[model samples]
Target: MRILILTHRVPFPQNGGYPIVVGNTIKGLVSMGHEVSLISINVKKHSGRQHERDDLLNKISYTEYGIDTHISVLEVFSNLFTRNPYNINKYYDAGFEKLVLQNIKDNHYDVVQLEGLFVGPYVAAIRKNTTAKLIYRAHNIEHQVWHRLAHQKNDPFKKWYLNLLARRVKKYELELLNQFDGIAVFTGEDKNAMESFGAEIPLCVVPIGVDMGKYQPEPDKTECPSLFFLGSLDWLPNREGIEWFIENFHKEIVDGDLKVKFYVAGNSIPEDFDEYDVPDKVFIQGEVDDALEFVNSKSIMIVPLLSGGGMRVKIVEGMAMKKCIISTTIGAEGINFAHGDNIIIANNAGEFYDALKRCIADEWYCREIGENARKLVEQEHDVNKVTRDLVAFYQSVI
Candidate 1:
């Protein structure tokens, strides 16, 4: 199978869950004797410089399009006049579309795997030019963000603007679904969400995979009183999740007569969230090199995620580290586990506070839940098995 992979984010570093998943899938396909060619956008570098995908894909070939040193005034003006969300506007460049069309016509790829809706426009361009199987991997329903933003919107004009943007994007997303052979979502929840939207294509659920070898539980995890929350800061849901935790749960556990510290680790802390103003119990560690290393010293992993879609890779990563997970029902999106079995789930502030306190008080119970969670991850979300299943799905679709 000659598979052509497309994604908005560069699959280098394998840090953020999405890019890492795509990068790992490509490697898996290649290892399984399939030809994998990737057409990815070069992610904007922070210091106005060039970026490198990690050594895992050092030999993995790809074509990088839409690599601007920085966003220009012209692009901003165009996006503003065009009414496109700034999120999608940056990816709407000519080079990405051109390369996609060229690959479809010249390469005769077996399957064109699009990483997210951001690249949906290319599916039609490819289908129009060549005979290829198109599959869109919905990382999460994009509209969920709009739903959250709509709630977070305080201003009338701002709320109206976000509602309008969400409406437009949803239409684009629905139209894009008509152009694909199938839709692969990261979680069962996302699969159901797409179905609810009336997506007629083959709907499949494939959860995120974790490198169990690196994320295995620690032998000394029984000796910490810390909690962790990790995600890519650029994601609005992550920001919203953390903000909700701060405003709602920070005191429930820390100030509610429980002796615990919250360690929030991720990239790009909104400048306003600087430490000078953060709650005393919350430690905002911006962008650590390795989240596991920072979290290894914690007693339990916390996912007060109020809103988001897809399986939380951070949850699996923490479970991989052999730590007990305490998350809201919304936090534990994709990974299906019943209460008191593999994880401890709480939906509101009172429940969340009680769960954390109870887990902390019962050392034996915490260990049991943590061990069970790790076992579930190894059995279900291991990369080796996950990649095998993904390859089989691709083969079937092709």
Candidate 2:
């Protein structure tokens, strides 16, 4: 099978969630004996980094087009008058459109997979220029994330703008449902949501997977009784959730005489993000050398995602590393785990505090939860298994 994968961001480095998904999926496809090619956009952030993937760089061909991904005052104001969603409009480039059309004409592929909604705008060009089957990989119900953020926003202007964008995104997403031959979603819940919105095409639930052999737990290295949160801090959901945690729960937990320390680690921490009072207890360690090693060093993983959709790759990686994870209902949206069995669900501040305290007090129960979490990922989310299943789905669709 020959496949062409298109993404809005370069998938190398695999530092963030989207990159991890794109990188692993491509590697999986290649491992299954498929000839895969990649066409990705190179933004300012990923500009200077090395795009080296030993297993993939030598095997597959790739192209990276430069684009501007900055958010400016002019762009925001200009979006107010446009009918297209701001998120979609910001990523659409004439050069990228022409390149995609040219690629399709030059090298015919069996399937042209759009990584997410951001790349959906080029579907018209693919449909017109090629005979390949179109596959729209719905990372999440794109509009729902904006909708959730709008409700959570306090500022009137921001809330109104978010609501407008959400409506436009929902409209655009629905139109693309019938435009593609098949849709691949990150979870069954997402598939159901799309079907409810009148998506009638062939759909498959392709969950985000992890390399199990690479993510085994290291018990001796873990910092027991410590809680940590790891993700891209520059993202809206991560920033908001952390701010909320500090405002509502952090001080209480620190003052309660609990012997628990909190750690925050990720890329792109903002310049003015000083929400916490005590810097010692809540350590802000930005950009670690090894994410998997950093994760293994922690006892508990906190995923307080107040907004956003799709399965978080960090949570899946955490599960694979045998870490006891505490996440909000929205945070653990797609993963199939019972609350007390594999993971802990905490929505509000009070529940979060209580869960933390419980884990601190009962080491045995925490260890049991972590053990179950690792077992679940090994059985269901191994990368090889996921890729084999995905190939079968592709064959069926073909």
Which residue pairs collide in model 1, if any?
A: 215-320, 266-287
Judged by whole-model lDDT over C-alpha atoms, candidate 2 comes out at 0.86
- Writing each residue's lDDT as its tens digit, candidate 1 over 1-398 gives 88888988676666677776887677667667778888888766633444464665655567766565357778755665664566565576777788778767788788888898777656656778877788888888887867667767679987776677677678777767767888888887788778888888888887777667677546574456666777877887777777877787665555577677777777777766664244657677777876667767777777877666777777877777778888888778888776888899988878877887787678788778888888888888887778787767776777
Where in model 1 is the C-alpha error above 4 Å?
A: 45-53, 68-86, 104-106, 152-157, 221-223, 249-256, 276-281
Q: Candidate 1 at 261: error in angstroms?
A: 2.2
| Model 2 segments more than 4 A misplaced | 49-54, 274-279
Listed in order, each prediction's TM-score against the native is: 0.89, 0.96
How well does candidate 1 match the true structure, expressed as C-alpha RMSD? Answer: 3.0
Please tell me which predicted candidate would have the highest TM-score against the true structure. Answer: 2
Give the total clashing residue pairs for model 2. Answer: 0
- Global lDDT of each model? 0.75, 0.86
Per residue, candidate 2 scores C-alpha lDDT tens digits across 1-398 of 99999999888788889989988898888887899999999887768756456566677889989999787899778888889787886788999899988888899799999999999888887898998889999888889988998999999998999899999999998988999989888898899999999988899998888788788788999988888889998677888887787677676657765578888888887655545536557777777879999999989889999999989898999998888999999999899989999999999987987898898888788889999998998888888988888888888888
